[model samples]
Target: MDEAVKFHFVVDGNDFTSAGQASVQIKKNLRQLGIAPEIIRKVSIAMYEGEINMVIHAGGGEADVLIYENRIEIILTDNGPGIANIDLAMQEGFSTAPDNIRSLGFGAGMGLPNMKRYTDAMQIDSTFGKGTRISMTVNL
Candidate 1:
């Protein structure tokens, strides 16, 4: 693509049923754009994890996907209590999800780690009481 294509989605924090919808839509869009399956998978996984995090912790958020000729960028923004420790949060099996969320099998503390694993690059910006913004990119 000569110019970047963008897609925006609003996640509903009140409804767990709506989580992951943005990633699913992004996957379909990538497939339709003829992007490689592997790249699409990476983007989907990373974005899905971010989406779930927004729902479970951030009271929902906005996800924006930018499709470029050489890469794809996923931006997740939320206005919720920010992560206290980035290092600890990045560790596998480390989660702050509530018991109810865990009972539903949603929080395994693998969200950030898996997001990093699947994406080529990921960055997180958060403020303890303010909010968080995560940006991830996948090479095409």
Candidate 2:
């Protein structure tokens, strides 16, 4: 692509079955574009973890991915209750998800941490009653 390419996706919070659809699609699209396998894997994993967090806590969100020459940028935004503590939330096992949500095989509190683990850089902007936005980048 001559210019940066953008992809938008709407995450559905009601259904767990469809939570990771966007990430999967992103992976496929990158593959078709001949993106490096390592870069694609890292971005896809980070995006998938972010998507699951939106479903498990935020009730839904919007994800925008920008594909550029040397990097991929992912921005995930949601209108759910904002995270109360970024520092605490980054801990490996910290979680605020309901017990019911935990039972569904999520809420391990690994979402943000895992996202960071896979991406080169990540930042979270959140307000108590407003919402949250996370920006993550995976260098190509």
Candidate 3:
């Protein structure tokens, strides 16, 4: 690609049924763009984890994917309760999701860690009461 291509999505927090739609769409888009299978898989997994986290905690959020010649960038932003502790939240099994969300099999606290694992780089900016924005990149 000579120029960056961008895709934007608005996540719906009220509906668990629609939680993964964005990630699915992204996967399709990446595939259609002829992205490598490994890169597409990484992007899909990372995006899905971020999308689910937005639904379970952020009430709703915005996701943007920018496809560049050498890398792809995924940015997720939400206006819900921000993460209280970045270091703690990055742990494998720690979660702050409510009992109801946990009962629904959505929140296991692996979201951030998994996102990081699948991406080349990940950055998180959060305010306790305000919101959070996570930027992740996957090199091509």
Q: Which predicted model would earn the best TM-score?
A: 1
Give stretches of model 1 more than 4 Å off.
Answer: none
Q: Candidate 1 or 3, higher TM-score? A: 1
Instruction: Give the winner by lDDT: 1 or 3.
Output: 3
Comparing 2 and 3 on lDDT, the stronger one: 3
Model 2 reaches what TM-score against the true structure? 0.95
- Candidate 1, run of 10 with poorest lDDT: 1-10
lDDT of 2 by residue, 35-136 (tens): 989998999999999999989878989999999988899999999899999999999999988899788888898989999999999999999888899999
Tens-place lDDT per residue, model 3, 52-122, is 89998989899999999999999999999999999999999999988898888867889899999999999
Q: Could you estimate the TM-score for every candidate?
A: 0.97, 0.95, 0.96
- Number of backbone clashes in candidate 2: 0
Task: Give the local distance difference test score of model 1.
Answer: 0.93
Rank candidates by lDDT, best first.
3, 1, 2
lDDT of 1 by residue, 1-140 (tens): 27989999999998887798888999999999999999989999999999899999989999999988898999999999999999999999999999998888978999999999999999999999999999999988
Question: Candidate 1 or 2, higher TM-score?
Answer: 1
Q: Give stretches of model 2 more than 4 Å off.
A: none
